[model samples]
Target: MFVKISHLYAENFPQLTAPFRPIWGPKASILLVDDKLAAQLNLSPDEILAALQSDDVAEKTVAMLYAGHQFGQFNPRMGDGRAALLGEVSGQNGMMFDLHLKGSGATPYARGGDGKAGLGPVLREFLMARAMAALDVPTTGSLAVIETGEQIWRDVPQPGPVPGAILVRSAASHLRVGHVQYIATMGDDALLSRFIEYVLNRHNMRADAHENMALSLLQNVMERQAALIAKWMSIGFVHGVMNTDNMTLSGETIDYGPCAFLDEYNPASVFSSIDRRGRYAYGQQPAIGGWNLARLAEAMLSIIDDNVETAIEKAQSVLSGYTALYDAAWRDLFAQKIGLFEVHKDDGDLIKELLTLLAKHRVDFTQFFAELGPIFLGEKKRDADNFAAGHFGMDLAVWYEWKNAWQSRRDLESMDEIRILDVMRRANPLRIARNHHVEAAINAYIYKGDDGPFKALYAALSNPFEQREEWDIFDAPPQMNSPPFQSFCGT
Candidate 1:
């Protein structure tokens, strides 16, 4: 059965998008299907393939247009260069998600390069996005991956041709901060207002009696982004790239290129090979998030208020609140990880001290917290040996000292032992899509045409909080003295 795809964005804002058809390679085949998401949408792989092959959906496909600040420098013209928004579908949850096709070939924004995606990157996004979703992080979702029966030539990460592929991605809406920036920068005031209204309506963020619509929208976006970044920090996920275009107004994580989870607890960890300056390091995420929101605030300043001075003041007020929102969320999340259910004002100090200890000892970020549940419940010993293997040259006494301090704090709050263990288990993941594992899975599939390892890894990542003997291998981090992990943009 053919599932109808709504032309919501295209029919309403035709000027903001260019109609296009996907240029699929010969012998295109479905490489993977998100069966869970497919069932939610009442769709099947055959139906999805049929729709793409049919002219109806292809005719409705469009390449979005918007400009953005790439790495602090403004790129006046940029959009879906290698991708097309096929249309929209309503899920059982009654939310409209855009079905976007990546690596579908070039459009006007392709600039001069070929609008194709390497299979490695397509699979990378497929795994990363799904892993994030299961981890309870708000993100764009992958629907399917289709092999294009073609080759993509690239030099970085390796010097050879790789197989080409397309990923069908689903998101709440592809309306990015850059979308509003485009209209405002072009002096199209009327279009900007229309677009803003469209977004407000889509997200059910109508202005209340106390606030103007544009100002309310800015505040709403700021709040979402603050919460989103805190979630990313809670798990040790580094987005690698934080460009304005990649910052969705929907506040979901997008553009998974070079993204990775931390192995060691260093705040300064950076895995993106292109991030030599560490602009988007693990610790810098919160600040960069605020920086990106500031860009959006600047773009919407005109509609925020009639008077320029008044608009700046109003936008500044909303921007000022981002730090506090992020701080509170970060503190609360970290508190949960350490079994401090009732967050105290001074809890920040405790969190900071433990992180400092982990960093000083080069401890595995995920393992230290994950092992806490069993150790606290008496299922595993609470001695220094439990954490000794993950770090080196550490005073065993310091471990006991930190544990005593943590226990004292929990006792001060009158926290129950079993309840604290439950909270810690929920807050900390037993397994994560570690960098070495992800790289190994990608290498296996790309070189040997093997999906067994990739499938197994995804299955383990899907149930990160659960204890499974079969997935115990994923709990291990990459070994010390191994080469530092690096990821490429796969552009």
Candidate 2:
């Protein structure tokens, strides 16, 4: 029983409305579905499938209107061109979740583009979103993927049209900062107020005073975003397109377009083909995150206070706190990565030094941290030596010096070695959704119509922290001489 949740967004802002159009040649064959999430939502696989396949579902769906700042430029109108909010489901935990369908069909905001998705991008989002969840990063979860049995043209380096698919993406809420910004730009104070109240109630956030509701919401979103971005940085995840529209107010990592995990520890790594200027690089994520939050703050100004000067000051104060919140989160996570139970003044410096060394030597980001667990636990000296030699090559002397300094700090902490090693094991994942492996899987599925690689990669990434013999190959980085890998927005 899918309950329509009052259609609060559409009811509040009728001007920003569009109806969902049915998928062309809709053949809903399930490619991937999350049984775990299904159970959480109290829906069986068959029931979920039945509901999705129902003809009425398309008619009931709504495509939302919004705007975004793309590549530091504001586009005043960009909405769900190819996606639709099917309906909302109340989870077992009493939390409200939205089931949005990507590649559903055409919407009013299609803007001359086909309202469809390629199989590769759908599979990529499913894999990457689940992998992020396993790594304890807050992210939207894929409920199911249904192959549409249609071909969609894409601008991939390859020549032909690719197979189309629809991804059932579940999120705490699909509302974005851009949505609020859109309402604010309309100059409709009543609609903006209703939207803010809807968000606060939906997210279960409370405000002490009516006058402070917007400021309170802004504070909550900022704190969650700070912690969320820190989690992404700790795991080497680059949200390649950090546009305001892509930044979900629910604090979960949303869109997977052009997103990738770092292989070699270069802060300036750019995977998104469209990011020619490297605006959303790995290291720049925090700064970009702050910039997005500033946009949110700007949108909330009128709601925060009636006086323009007062509202700007209030927003500025909150925006200024983002740096401290981000820095503290980064420090704590980096500390955990290095197996430090307690923070020391020099811990930040030590962490920076290690990252500097990794960057200089071009070490694999996942492997470097994963290998450290065994070395710190004294399980494999030979492997540790080989890893050191492999990473440092002729520069073993400096590597050894850094290793010695790190060990000295560990020793000085007097923390139980077993406890420290346990933290390290949990902090360092043995496998990530590696770009090369993901590409190989996509290639297998797209060209050969084989899903073996896709399934295997999903299984390996499902439990990335575990050391499993079957997944050992997934841990290795791609060959150094392999062709440079690039990702696209899959639009």
Candidate 3:
């Protein structure tokens, strides 16, 4: 069923585009359209194509304002910059998701840069968001990418490869806490109160009765974010930026720019070139989440409780939920990664032990976890011939050393070993967004307009944990010629 979105508040902000169609703006080129999403808007692919080709209002934009911290410095003027809210619709499972456009144009918060996106960043977000959805992550979905048929100057001059990037994206809501904070900094307490009320009414009415509604909302987002972050780590995913404005109050992975997964075990590794200080590093994500939530709390201080102090105390209490929630969520996810069904408290120790082993061996997180099936069955073998059946002897010594503790504790004879093997098979992914693979896709598209490599990558990553039939190249990491990958912040 299609859910209709009404008009945006017109009196407060000036419409930048033609009055006849506020959603229509300076988009240059229109390319691939996702037909599945196009159909949901009661639109056909051809209609969407025509909409892009003409100056039609393809999206119902709801432009929002927000403020946030940039690299630990308070930027009271930050908002969507180049992005605009396209509006919301109810989709699969009664979830109402917002479909917005990025790289549309400069807004109240353009911050002196042309509100444009590079092709690399655009394609990266597209592939990453799709891969994440397949991995069962709550994320913004990519609907389309339009090349403006223009070249944008970045680290140097290059074609945005399209005009500039035009992406139609889907999200739960665009009412970020940073938006509330931005209004607060305007010194209009009434505006802040309205903002708080607007957010509470939209996403967290359950917390409305509480004196500290914003704090209550923060708690909700924290619990969801903790689980989401843990799920990312369990699957070797890295979100290069954990900035406050980028974090949605609705608890979804909002931005996918400059994100990649680990191909080798380096806890401190950062793939985003702009993340030189590792502000959003692998281990620092939880801390960054806490810090970002604190900003959200600070934004709500004006109207959160009856007075200020009580609200501060309430936010402090809620912020404490971060560590406990993250810990529990992480342990549970890692337990699944380790292929354990009935988790005892000792399972935590068991997990840590394996991670320590991985660190020592410098094993690639994805390939190592995925090797569990072959390794476990090798351990249960009655004779050397049985181990050879699965080529489990390729790295026989390291494999045996790893499963030695499992043999000491679990009952391989009493338990169905095949069941355990099956668990391992599903727990670990057969494919992931390896850096080289993404590069291959980009290069293939830019050079030969070849879709074969990307199609194969998508097929593999779509069913990450499943054993696909054409699994030769996808099963293993790229060879030495394509060793490490480094993605940069498109800024």
TM-score of each: 0.97, 0.96, 0.85
* Candidate rank order under lDDT: 1, 2, 3
lDDT by residue (tens digit), candidate 3, 1-491 = 12354334323333222222222234555565555556555445555434433332333454566677766777776667677765555566565666677876665566797777776677777777778888888787777777766666776224333325677777667656567667768777676666566555666446743545566677777777788888888888889877777787777888787788887666777877678898987877878888888888887777667678987888788787789898888887777666666656677787787776666555678877776656556453454345333334355565566567655545533446677677667777777888887878866875677868876776677678777578657667766455456776565
lDDT of 2 by residue, 48-84 (tens): 6667656766566788899899999998898999888
For model 2, where is the 10-residue window of minimal lDDT? 2-11
lDDT of each: 0.86, 0.85, 0.68
Tens digits of lDDT, candidate 1, 70-105: 878888779999989998888888888888998888
Model 2 TM-score (2 dp): 0.96
State which candidate, 2 or 3, has the greater TM-score: 2
lDDT of model number 3 = 0.68
In candidate 1, position 38 carries an lDDT of: 85
Error of 1 at 270 (Å): 1.3
- Which residue pairs overlap in candidate 1's backbone? none
lDDT of 1: 0.86
Q: What global local distance difference test value does model 2 have?
A: 0.85
Clashing pairs in 3: 147-162, 147-163, 148-162, 148-163, 148-164, 149-162, 149-163, 150-163, 151-159
